[model samples]
Target: MIMDNWISIKIAAQGPFDLKRTFESGHSSFPIPLKDKQDRWYLVMRPTSINTVIITRVAQQGSNLVAEISCPQRELKENEVQSMKKILRTTFGLQLNLAAFIEEFKKDPIAPAFELYRGIRLTRAHNLFQSLICSILTQRNSIWRWNAQARTMAKLLGEKYPVGHFLIYSFPEAKTIVNHSELLTKASLGYREEYVLETAKTLANKEKKLEKLKKVPTNEAQNALLELKGVGTKVADMFLLYGLGKMDAPPVDIWIQRAVSHLFFKKKEQTLAVCRDKLNEHYGKWAGLAQLYIYCWARDHLK
Candidate 1:
């Protein structure tokens, strides 16, 4: 049932909004690549059930970004609209005023590179469990490998819906994984299979845990996530930073270590702990944000 009327919500942003940069930051496969014919970005997501909603940034009128939101199952209900609004706002970082972060970056040594990618923010996972799984799958693996595994996981466990002639799949929920732990092996998860299953079961056991994590202090939340199987320091920090909306959490991988070393430590040798401390000291609350932008930039631009 296609409703003739689509609700138009205006989002005025504090900093410059660049949909292209945000999508290209190597987040995942949800946001479809640019299409000249559409002249906008399309995001397909499923927050509940197997049913999916397709959100598009339809237009930019002055300082506001107008969103055209629609779901295949039905017209969005009042509560659904609020949910979509919150998810979209968070996904696009509209609530994050980056003026101060950008100002601080301008004074840094890599200011030019950071400025070149100013509007790019961390495109977060759909949920906390999904973020944990992503971090686990990405550990010590190439981006290509993790993306392939993610796509396979999506197709196998996610609910499928028809969008025109095409079928769209959502990211698998923890319940789905908990119900079918063996299916993960087909994705060649290897040693991480057990960890993924355990994490899924843990998340599925309590619906309130993810919600509780949002309210917990950053250090406690990090430790709690660390308790889950396959979750290490980097994975926990990534979950805290991207999943629980804690910008103070900086997940420093080798790339970030190199970037930090070169940009801040005068290319001196430093431990990951020392590097993370430096990033926190310099970027403060925006440390995670700075880490993401610089990580992406360094991955592509730096040696």
Candidate 2:
């Protein structure tokens, strides 16, 4: 019989962490995270290594974050619990030490952003496949539209689990997506449907390719991701940063391009390649975090 109890785990941040800023940052491409009246954040995800869906409730307890995880379909095992901890750590960037980056960029044009969005971390998606799909969905679309599409896809394709009085869905697996390709049309993906299907097929057959991206160098990983359908330079870089945790890969989208041009190029238009190169040259390994701060700052101040 399935257990009704929740397993609680506490995770310590390496330096400073802000649970509210990180969860509401709007930096990630995953479906919007849910927060209840009690200030608890809820995430429904299926870790790649685990066989079941996990519902996690995260709330800040002093300096540390406490996660109450539940597997409604079955009893949570020891190995799965360990894997959940690792996944939560990765997803929330609990182990990242950002003191150096903050100290280095304290005087730069993006410095004000650091103060405004303090404790905002680079949040990752559930897994590589989900990241890839979310990247594809963001192409030529606004954040709200793409997020809605992703949520719709999850509702249509993902496994439904009961959490309290609510039912949540896990992001569908590649094999599940491959089997349900027709449902992509219903998700309002438009032209992205074909790309999502092809990518899902590739992942379903050779998922190790996606897993291996975590071990490879940044440029090589970007190249491999670029080979997939609907993946361009921006999409590849997005996957690199958010999917595989490559901090040096900063994606240059329209918003980032505008921000970079304004701050570094004196509002003069520059090519995407040049903008990306400038970010790499300036921030080096901290380019991804820089991009997030600048992007958020630009969205507010630039417009």
Candidate 3:
């Protein structure tokens, strides 16, 4: 069922929401939002079950958000619309209830960070395969470099759709990636090329196994992700937190380790395991979100 024009949908945020802060929170794994001349933010993506490129113009309206979504290449079905709504909700953390976490940590040392990045939310990847590849790319890599590589990969291999005067791309599927594995080298993936291709082959062969992690316990999912090539503790934690929505998995990168050391360990160097345990003890289920905030704050203030 193709519509003649773009369809509009309204989604209500469960709590305080800031579109700008959430979309541009410096999470390299998440797709970057493009701003038009009118300053409207638009994100282009594809539903997991369909190849049609969906374009959404997101705007904040009071306590609710408006997503003016359209399938530029075809008509969107009702079920696809529903799936898009769910994806948007998860991507923006629209259903996250942070009231208790905010109130409890309002006076803590990281409290200033909470205020500084008040409306920011944990932004997840569009899919597990994308997240896994991104985690591999980020290993021993600068943020700018990895992000560029991701965008280049998408541009070269992803499906492109023309919306209005602009052209946008949806991240390529696993099979497409597997078939076009050689193109990845052009993206400058370097040593990560083998890991990414092998991961894509696994996803193409056993996608159900990867998707099943979303419903499993955090520790169990982390263990399974660790079995994949190029996945270490940090990469496994990243995939669990950002890909599987396991909020208890705190990704202890260098920035987060430094933040935890200074704030909780009195400037003493702490092991990554120690930082993870401290974050879990202090923040509990919200440890992943806390890690995101601390990472952003440290990147800005610590340097």
Best by TM-score: 2
* Order of quality (lDDT): 2, 3, 1
Give per-residue CA lDDT, model 1, range 1-303, as digits (tens): 332455766677777676666666765323333333445544446564223555344444554567777666666777777777777677667788776667766777657765678666565655555667877887787776776777678778976654333455667788889898778889897788888888888878664477688798888988888888788888788777777678888888898998888888888868888888888998888888888777886897767
lDDT of 2 by residue, 1-303 (tens): 232688999988876678887766667847666677888877787777895677888899876889999877777899889888888888888767767788888899999888898888788867667888999988898888888898888899987766555666778889999998888889989999999999998889676578888898988988888888888999888888888888888989988999999999999989999999999999988888899898889888877
- Of candidates 3 and 2, the better by lDDT: 2
Per-model TM-score on C-alpha atoms: 0.86, 0.93, 0.91
User: Candidate 1: what lDDT?
Assistant: 0.70
Off by over 4 Å in 1: 1-6, 27-65
Model 3 misplaced regions, further than 4 Å: 1-4, 49-53, 72-74
Which residue pairs collide, candidate 2? none
- Cα miss at 105, model 2 (Å)? 1.6
Task: Give the alpha-carbon lDDT of every model.
Answer: 0.70, 0.83, 0.78
Error of 3 at 289 (Å): 1.1
Candidate 3, residues 1-303, lDDT tens digits: the string is: 232377787778765677777766766355566666755566666545565667777787876677788876677889888888888787777768766677877888888887788777777766667777888888888777777787788888987756556766667777888999889888888888888888888788566567778888888888888888888999888888887788788889889889999999898989999999999999888888889889989989877
Q: What is the lDDT of residue 195 in candidate 3?
A: 86
